[model samples]
Target chain A: MIQSFKMALKSIAGNKLRSFLTMLGIIIGVMALVILVSLVSGATGSVTDSIFSLGSNLLTVTISDDKGAPINLQTLNEWMEKDGIGLIAPSGETSATARYEGNSGSVTVYGTTPPYETINGLSLLLGRFIKSSDVDNHTNVAVINETAATELIGYTDCIGEEVSLDGVKFTVVGLLEDDEKSLTAVFGRGSVVAYIPYTSLMRLSSEATSNITSFSVSAETDMATAEAAVTSLLMERFDQDDDAFTVSSRDMLEDAMSDVTSVLMILLGSIAGISLIVGGIGIMNIMLVTVTERTREIGIRKAIGAGRGVILQQFLLESVVLCMFGCAIGVFLSWAVLRIISVVVSSLSISFSLEWNVVLIAVGFCFLIGIVFGLYPANKAAKMEPVEALRYGG
Target chain B: MIDLKNVSRVYQVGSGKVYALNKATLHIDAGEFVSIVGPSGSGKSTLMNIIGCLDIADSGTYLLDGIPIEDYTETELAKIRNRKIGFVFQSFNLIDKLTAEENVELPLIYRGVGKAERKARVAEVLERVGLTKWSHHLPTELSGGQQQRVAIARAIVTKPSLILGDEPTGNLDSKTTGEIMEIFRELHEQGNTIMLITHDQEIAEQASRIIHIRDGVLSEVSI
Candidate 1:
């Protein structure tokens, strides 16, 4: 058996070009699967990590009127003293054009108090976080993301610089790095973000209203009791139906992200699966031809003393070797693609991990293709009568 | 010794039955050099195939060394062919991808011989066939006569009891023909039972006895 294997290897080596061509289908199939799966997994892992990094126990609560009525600040102030919620950071957000020097880019200005930074896990890279005094005194101080800061001041410290939004001057108190760059919205193609005090923002902006766009909340330690208490508080404050607004916990958001990613992965995997089918068909086609071409050789071997089993082994081995070599090349290509992707999306922490089980499954599928495609040829070769095969040529 | 008792083979050829062999019975003792001479379709090749265990007789008792072979399976027949018989074909069916030595080692490979012993035996057989110098060369690189010698080496390397030649020198020149006959004469002298099939009387004359076949029937003549 070992000797036959050596002979088989020599035969394949003898026809290097033909062997490589035969491996083409396998190469493309494996590469497609590996690259698509790794990319999807990397994206999924990044999104999941970003959500958890925002603090797993975090929740968001917002109250809106059924008829879209303006929020009454007096009622909201009473609700803010609700018994169940431990922390609430109301935020008002709007989009505007910002100009720094001669370069201009569109940016979203988030209006929020100092408590919003701690609730949303925003940290300062330079200087300090937004202060309660700044919000109370209605100071026009801003905390910008690293991207915004870099664009406005280059590498110079922006701690004392002023950035103008719509010709309104705001002193830079701190620079914050955007974590949501990793947890991007569906249609958001990465934009710069700047933050300022909600009171100052409301006073200067024309579209400002008492209607709060959203609020991040940290419920008391007893979430069940807090949920009930907050529900009644909102009902009393809004004086409307119980279902007037929506409240979502971090776990719920994570679950939704997981579902979306799972569907995406399945869709991508099926797309990759088409190539494997093509590859398997290619193997079957080549194997059938090989059997026909080697019919006389099969006869000669059998005439000399080889059994049906030996003939089967030789051809099956050839098929598997072709596919396995292609799979190896595919794995290498996947890793190369990931390296390129990481370079392209450096701001987002996306890692293409190697899953051994997935690789093993791919290998198993390759072997199955070999055997499934090799069956017809092997049977035909095995059933050949030695006398007829010897007599075939003459 | 070999025995055939009422052996016959029939083939279904498109609504017509072709009698390849017709109830032919013959016997030969050990170490006999015999020839079967006939034109195409005369069943000489069919007889050779049956004797070599390449095919089974339709209805007959073929006893090789006192064992009935018609009852044997295909695998059993292959083992018997490898151990008891060798074949030399007119076209010299040496595997083109194999070197001369590797081609010669094929039969021994089936016999489950160790690699060391197989190599040693292959060298001895190649030397005996005057192919030692060309042992590393492929069949395509060798002359017609040399390629036939490689085929002969491959046949005999397993040390089979009987060597069957189907027009072994049909493709050779007259001069190469005489050289091949000399090798046959030497092999027969070494006590190997030999059977050859040919249409040429001059080639058949080299054997000790001749069997003539016409339309699938055989008649014997002393040579």
Candidate 2:
């Protein structure tokens, strides 16, 4: 076996470029596999992460339209304080540019009640969050996230500082940690956030503030009953008009995102897998050519005392080495490419983690490709008659 | 020792049976140098191949060292080839990818010789072939004569009991031919049994006994 392995190495070393070209297919195949696994796993990781960060059991209520009699805040609050509801933090949002000295960036100005941070798993990194008295007084006070602190103020711990937004000065009482899958970015230029009293934001609202974007509600018991209660409460309040308002659960969001990811994985996996099969065929084609090219050599070996088994072993091992070589190259390329992309585009929230199991599967597939494609050519060389093979020109 | 009785081989050329060998009987004692000389397609190669355990006769009895060839399985025949016979071909079929030392190690590797012993034996054989200095060169890097000597080193590295040379000097110049024949003469003097097949009469004359094959018939000619 060792002898055959040595021979395989020598044979490959004889034509290094040709060997690499032949392995191009395997490289592409393994690369596709790695990329596909990374994309799916990375997307899934962020989705599940966001869902978990929504705290233990949470429901989001959205009044999509508020043209007629608007949603009564007191009625909604009283209903949420009833059976399955543990807490409610109604919120509204508007896009505004925040300025502190010369550092001005677009930010999402959020209007919310107190329990927002506790229900939504948000933490104060430096100072206090918005309080109920601030909401009742309609104070021009703000609790800014890390993005606002860094992008506008250029540093952390900007507690008790004041930043002007939409030409109104608001005190930054708290510095909340940045929400890692930033939903605020979906509304504005991203990287800056501020939360003040809902009444203060509503009083300054233009046309966009008529409807609430969403308000988070924690379940007193579990998520299922909270979602059901929220759905039914909205259904009764809107005269059983299900389309008037929407209620979504963290579990539902997770399931939807997971389903999308599954479909994405299958589609990407097959496209990549097809390329791998193409690469395996490429290996087979080259191996067959190699056997033909080495027919005379095979004859010589056989004449000089090589058995059929020995010839088969030598040829098979040569192909196996070729595939594994390509695998190593492909693996390195994929890892490097993924690392660069994640680092260069840090805000993408799409991480490219190394999936060892996927890599192992790809490696194993390389061996399978080696054996399946190599057997025919190796056997062909092994079965040749010495006299006939000796006469072969190549 | 080698024995043959009424050995024959038939090839299907298109739709006709061409008998490359026909019931040609011959014998050679242990430690004798014998040559079979014939014109091209006169069954010289057929006879050598059969004797070298490289081909099976359709109908005949062949015995190598007292074991009937027909009784052994294909794998057994391979073992017999690996263990007992050394072959030198007309083309000097040294694998182009292998260095001279690696080429010479082929048969010994097949015989499962240990690394240390294979190294020692390969050095000794390369020295015997008078090409010890070129032992590390690839076949393509060596001259024709040097390549043939490497092939010879490879053939004898296992110290195979029977050495069969099929037109071993067919591809060489007259000078190189004489040099290779001198190596054969030295091996013969060392009491190694050697069988050579060639179409050249002068090459045949160098052997102690010459046998002629014409139209698939074998006749002994005193040398």
Candidate 3:
């Protein structure tokens, strides 16, 4: 058995070009499998992290038209006072240019109530968060992220300083810090985030109470009750016969993202698997040709005492060796590509992780492919009559 | 000793049956140097295959050392081939990827010899064949005569009772053929049973007795 295996290995190595070509299919298949799974998981990880940071207990309520455009906040506010509700935040987002002295930069202005900061997991790097008094008093105070403060005020003191938004001055009350590098691009222009009183923002944007962009709500203790209360409240507020608003908890959002990623990974993996099948066919074809070329050798080996099992083992081992070689190359290439992608998308929280389990699965698949395809040729080689094989090319 | 009461092999070729061997009967005791000589398609190679346990006769009985051949399964026959028989081919059918020593180690490997013993026996066989110096050289790297010697070394590595040669010197030059025949003569003198198959009368004459076949039927021709 050992002798047969050694001979098979030698025979495969004898034809370097053929062996390499046979491995190419497996290489591509494994590479595709690794890269696709890595990318999908990376994206899913970042998204899930982002959603969790938004506070799992909190739910966002947006008053929107049938086509999903924001509607009146007055009606949304009336609905929030319903039974089983705890807290509701009507938030508005706007893009505007902020200038301090000569330097000017684009900033995303999030106008909301005081509860918005706590609900969204925002931390003040300097000064204080927006207070209830600020909303009531319609204060012209602004809390800006480190990026916005830096861009608008340079290295100068930002707290108590005034930053002009489209020539309208507002006093900087606090500085906010970004959680991850990914937050900058996802939130808006770079890391520029500014928070102002909702009343002031509504006055500045010149919109009526009808323009309620979004609302963030938290359930009152019981989850089942919260779900039922929120759904019914939204239904009643919208005056619709059916459910209209998209109300999802943190768990639901995470699950949806996970499902999407799983499907994407599977699709990509199947595409890679197609290449694996092609690779298996390549192995089969080469092995069959090898069996033909070594017909006389096969006969001699059989005559010298190699049985059907030994012959089968030899051919099968040759194919498996080819696949294993390809698997190594493919894994290496996938990791290299993932590394390059990681470097390129540094700001997106994208990371590629190699799963050894996946690699083991790939190896097993390669072996199976080899054995499945190797059966026919190996059987043919084993069953060859010594006399006929000896006379084959004589 | 080898015995054949009656042996026949019929092959399916297209729509009709082709009889490769027809009701052949032969016998040889241990230590006999014999030859089966016939033109191509004359059943000499087929008879050799049957004798080597590489193929079974279609009908009738064959006994090698008093054991029935037809009743043995392919695997059992493989064990017999590995244990009792060695074969040298006309083309010097050595594995191209293996060194001469490795090729010699093959049969022993199938016999489940330990690595150390297999290596020692392979070395002994290579030395016996006078190719110990080329033990590390692959078959393709060696001359045809050297490769044939390696094949001979491989065949005898396991110390089998019989050595089956199918036109073993067909690919060698006259000098190399003479050299191989000399090795065969030494082996025969050493009490090793040899069955040489050839179409060449010159080669057949070197054997102690010649058995001829024409159109799948045996005929005796004394040399």
Candidate 4:
């Protein structure tokens, strides 16, 4: 077997250009498989990380129909005191134009109470989040993100500065720190955003209502129990109509995202696999030519006492070695390609790296292809009659 | 020792049967230097192939070293060829990509010889053939005589029982042919069984006994 491998290497080395051209198909196929799958997995990983960074223990509740029992600030406070529920914050949002001195910019205004900071994992760089007193007194105060502060107020330290929303004045009491690794940072790069007390938002924007339609709840312990408690509460509030409200946890979103990405990965993988099959066909084609070209050599070996099995093994090993070499090169190139991609998307903080399993799959697939495609030609060479083969091309 | 009884090989030439070998019977004792001289298409190669275990006769029994050749499987025939017969072809059929030493080591490899012993045997045979300095050169790099010498070395490397030469010097010049024939004469003197197939009357006269074939019939000619 080792001798056959040596012979295979010699034959492959004997025809450098033809061998490389044959392996090029396999190389491209493996590159496509490894790079595409790794990119999807890397992107999915970063997205999941960012989603968890937003707080996996948090549940988002949206009420399509409040029915008769509309949730208010008092009701949210009461729900927070319930079992498995750590904190509950009523949230509503509206797009409004904000002006400070001569600077004006459009911003998304999220209306929520103090616990919204912890529930959503938002941190303030200056001042404080909305206190319960602000929500109760309907205070005209707003907390703006770093983008809003820098864009509208021209600086982050502009705390206590007055910014007008649709001609209504509100004091900017806090500035949010910028988190470039967050999902919002990636999807909402240049957008200005602000947070105000839910009561104040209801008063300032015509689209914002006193009835809470959306809210976020953070679990004190197990998320499943907390989700169950919230669902039952909504079910009771909406007269046992489960469809009146939908309570979604971060786990659901994470699962759905992974499912989508996995499908995408398979789609990409099989498409690349097709190219690999094409490459295998290329190997078969060249191997056939090689067998025909070296018919006399086959005859010489046979006449010198080589058996059919030995001849078959020699040709088969040659093809498999060719494929494996291509696979190795493909994997290395994929890693380099991923590195280039990582550098390109460094600002987004998503690093693309080669996954080991994908590399293994590529290698295994290449080996299989080698055996599958190399068999016919190897068998052809093996089954040739020694006398006839010896007489060939004389 | 080799034995054949009523051996016949038939070929279908467009719905017509042509006998390549026609009920010919022959025997060669151990250590005998024998030659079969025939014209082209006179079944010289067919007889050589059957004797080499490269082909099976359609009808008849061939025995080499007392084992029936027709009863053996393809793999067994290959083993017989590897251990009992060494073939030297007219074209000096050395694989172009392999070095001379490697080509000489082919039969030993098929015989499952250990690497060290194969190397030793190959070196010894290369020295015997007066091509030790050319052992590492490829067939394309060697002269016709050197290439033929390498083929002879390859044939003898396994120390096989019989050396079958099918027109071994057919492509060499008269001087090279004499050189190759001298090597055969030396091997025969060393008690090796040698069978040389040739069309040259002068080369056949060099053998201890000659068998002439015409139209697939063999007749012994005392020289």
Candidate 5:
């Protein structure tokens, strides 16, 4: 084996350019694998982050009938207690034009109770969010988001300022921070948000007054179990009407997106893997030529009593050496290229991530390709009759 | 010792059977030197190949040092060849990439000799060919005479029972041929069994015995 290894090295060294050309396929194959797998991982990572951020441990309950019962706080508390859930935030939204100091523009007002901040992850940039007192008292105080405060009032710190929705005047109690970036991070693409008390909004004479569309719930443990419990509770409550309420969680959506990303990566990676086949074919092609060129050498060795196994090993080892050399070069080249690409795409938040597992798999794949493709030609050389091979000529 | 009884080798040439060897038979005891001479296509090489175990006869028994040739596997034949026979081609056939000593060590390597022993034997054979100083040079760096000396060194490094030379000086001029033949004659004088095949009558005449092959038939010639 050692002797065969030495001969293989010598043979490759003897034909430097041909050996390099044979390695090109492996280089391309591994490079493609690293870059494509990294991109897919990055994309899936971003998607999972957004979905997980939305509500990794939370479940959403919604009923289209809006019987004013499924979304009520009493009903939410009942389900929360039954399921050992910790928080519930009832949420509703409306697009309305607002005016302040002669500045007028549209604002999306999310009406919810006091638990919205903790449950829905709405943090305040200034002042305070809507409290339970404000909801119970039906106070006309509002929590305008960063966009609404700036666009409508021309003031980032607009607490205690008066703003009119249509014809109703209300005091801005809090300025909600902009969640536009986080939203884009979740959905891969965002706008702005505003908040007000659900009770105060119901006083605006909406036809669905006191009716609820959706409420978000959170449990302290075991999301799968919590989600199932919540879904079944909602289903049983809506026994009067089937398919009226829908309960959903982020994990299911995450799994779906994960599957999508996996299939996508495999498809793209397979396309890239084709280059490995092409590379293997190149190695085989060059190896066959090398066998023919070294026919007389094979003859001499055989005549000197080198066995068929030795000749096969020598040729097989040559191809393996070439492929593995190519793999090393490919890995280094792609790592360098990915470094440069990451630097260039830094502003775009797109990373070409090369993981160790991907590299190991690529290297292993390259070796298998070498053995598979190298076998036939090596066998051809090994099986040659000594006299016939020695007599072979131009 | 070498023995052949009715050994026949046939070649298919353009859909016709050409008798490269036709019931040819010969024998040589240990420590004897003989030469086989013939014109082109007269089966002289076919005979040498069979004797050297590089080729097998189609329909006869060949006993080399008491081992039946045709009945053994290629692997077994290779082992027998490695231990009992050495080959010297007219073209030298030294792998040019290897140094002189490395070429001489080839058969010993196949024989699984230890590195220390291989080094000693290779150095001894290079000295025997009067090429101790040229052991480190590649085949291309050596002159034709020196290269043939390396080939002869390679042939004798294993100290095999039989040394077969095929037109051992065919590629050399008269002076180089004389130098290479001098090495073979020395080995023959040292009690080594040697069989040299040459078409030149002058080359064949130096052997103690000469065998002629004409139309694939062999006969002894009185020296």
Candidate 6:
């Protein structure tokens, strides 16, 4: 076996250009496999991380049809006092043009009560979130994230600064810390955003209503019980019509996201796998050519007492070694490509690293391809009659 | 020792049957240097192929050192060729990629010899063939005579019972041919059995006993 391996290496080394050309298909195949799979996994990982960062025990409620029985801040507060409910924050959103010292931009204004901060896991960089008194007094105070602070107010420490929303003045009480890795940061492109008291938003924008159509709730205990409780409450409020509202927990959303991404990963991986099969065919083609070219060598070896098994072993080893070489180069190139991608997307904070499982799959797949593709040509060479082979080109 | 009785090899040519080797019988004792001479299409190669265990006869009972050659499987025949026969071809047939020493070690490698023993045997044969200094050179780097010497060393490295030379000096110049023939004479003196097949009268004349083949029939000629 060792002798066969040595001979295989010698033969491969003897024809450097042809060997490298033959391996190119395998190299490209492996690169595609590793890079595509790793990118999907890396993106999925960051997305999942951001999802979990939103708070795993949180449930979101959206009312498509209130059915003449709408939820309000008072009702949400009452629900917060019930079992399985930790905090309830009723929210509504309206886009408005905001101005600060004549510099104006369109900003999305989220109307929510004090419990919104805890439920959404929002962290403050300065001042404080909306207070319970602020909601009751209908105080025109706003909280802005880092993007809003930088884009509209020029800095993050803009607390106590008043900004006009559609010509109505509101004091900035808090500056929310920016999460570049958040799904919003990835998809929303850091747009100007603000959070104000729900009552204040109702007074400022005609589009804002007293009815709370959307709200988020953090579970005090298990999420399933909290979800069931909220569902029952919504069902009772809507005359037992479940279609009036929808209650979905963070865990369910996370599972759905992963399922979609995993399916995407498999689809991408198989596409790359097709390229690997093409690469294997390329190997088989070259190996067949090599066998024909070295027919005399086979005859010589056979005449000197080499059996069919030895000849088969030598040719098979040659192809396998060629594929493995291609795989090694492909893996290295994938790493470099991923490094480049990571550098390019560093602002999004999505680091694309080579996943070990994907690498293992690439390697294992390449080995299988080697054996599967190499067998035919090797068998052909092995089965040649010594005299007929010798007589070839004599 | 070798034995053959009524050995014949047939070939299908279109719709006609052609006899590559006719029903013929021959014998030679151990340590004999014998030669078979014939023209291009007179079955000299067929005779050599059968004797070298490369091709099976259609009808024959041939024995090599008391073992029946016809009863053996393909793998067993390969073993017989590896253990009992050494073939020197007209074109030298050294693998182009391997070094001279590596080429000489081929038979020993197939025989499953240990690396150390193979190396020692290879070196000994290279020294015997007077090509020790060229052992590290590839066949492409060596001269025609040197490559033929490497092939000869490879053949003798396993101490095979029969050294079958099928026009071994056919590609060499006259001087190199004379040198190769001298080596064969020395090997025969050392009690090694040798068989030389050639169409050249001068080359066959050098062997101790010569056999003539015309139209696939063989007749012994005492030299």
Q: Which candidate is the best by lDDT?
A: 4
Ranking by lDDT: 4, 6, 2, 5, 3, 1
Candidate 6 residue spans exceeding 4 A from truth: none
Two-chain DockQ for each candidate model: 0.65, 0.58, 0.68, 0.77, 0.57, 0.85
Q: Which candidate has the top score in TM-score?
A: 6
- Best by the DockQ measure: 6
Summarize candidate 5's per-residue lDDT along B71-98 as a digit string, tens digits. Answer: 8888888888889988999888888778
Runs of candidate 4 with Cα error greater than 4 angstroms are: A98-106, A151-154, A164-168, A188-191
Task: Report the Cα interface RMSD of each model, rounded to 1 decimal.
Answer: 1.3, 1.7, 1.5, 0.8, 1.5, 0.8
- In terms of docking quality, model 6 is high
Separately for all candidates shown, the number of backbone clashes (residues 3 or more apart, or on different chains) is 0, 0, 2, 0, 1, 0
**lDDT tens digits, residue span B1-223, model 2:** 7899999999999999999999989889988999899999899888888898888999999999998988876556778888888888888888887899999998888888899999999999999998889888889999888888888888788777899998999999999999999999999999899999999989999899999999788999884
For model 1, how does the per-residue alpha-carbon lDDT over A227-319 read when each residue is reduced to its tens digit? 666666666655657677767776778899989988987887777777887887887787788777877888788877877777888887777
What is the fnat score of candidate 2? 0.66
After best superposition, candidate 6 residue B48: deviation in angstroms?
0.2
Off by over 4 Å in 2: A63-71, A96-106, A121-177, A181-189, A200-203, A206-213, A221-246, A347-351, B71-74
Instruction: State candidate 2's DockQ.
Output: 0.58
Q: Over 4 Å off in model 5, which ranges?
A: A49-56, A62-85, A92-111, A122-126, A132-183, A186-212, A220-229, A236-242, A347-352, B14-16
* TM-score for all models, in order of appearance: 0.91, 0.88, 0.90, 0.95, 0.85, 0.97
User: If both were scored by DockQ, which would come out higher, candidate 5 or candidate 6?
Assistant: 6
Proportion of native contacts kept per candidate = 0.60, 0.66, 0.75, 0.68, 0.57, 0.77
Query: Per-residue alpha-carbon lDDT of model 2 for A1-394, expressed as tens digits?
Result: 9888988988898899989999999999999999778967876786677677676677888887544646655665787677888888888888888889888888878888888887887888887888888977889999998877887898887887889888888988988877776443322346577888887898766733535557888888988888888888777667778787878887778888889888887788788778888898888898999898888988888887788898899999999999999999999988988888779766666677777888898899889888988899899989988778888883
> Which residue pairs of candidate 5 clash?
A50-A186
Candidate 1 ranges with C-alpha deviation above 4 Å:
A62-84, A100-103, A154-156, A177-191, A204-208, A222-243, A344-349, A353-355
Off by over 4 Å in 3: A1-5, A65-86, A181-190, A206-213, A219-244, B10-20, B38-42, B200-202, B221-223
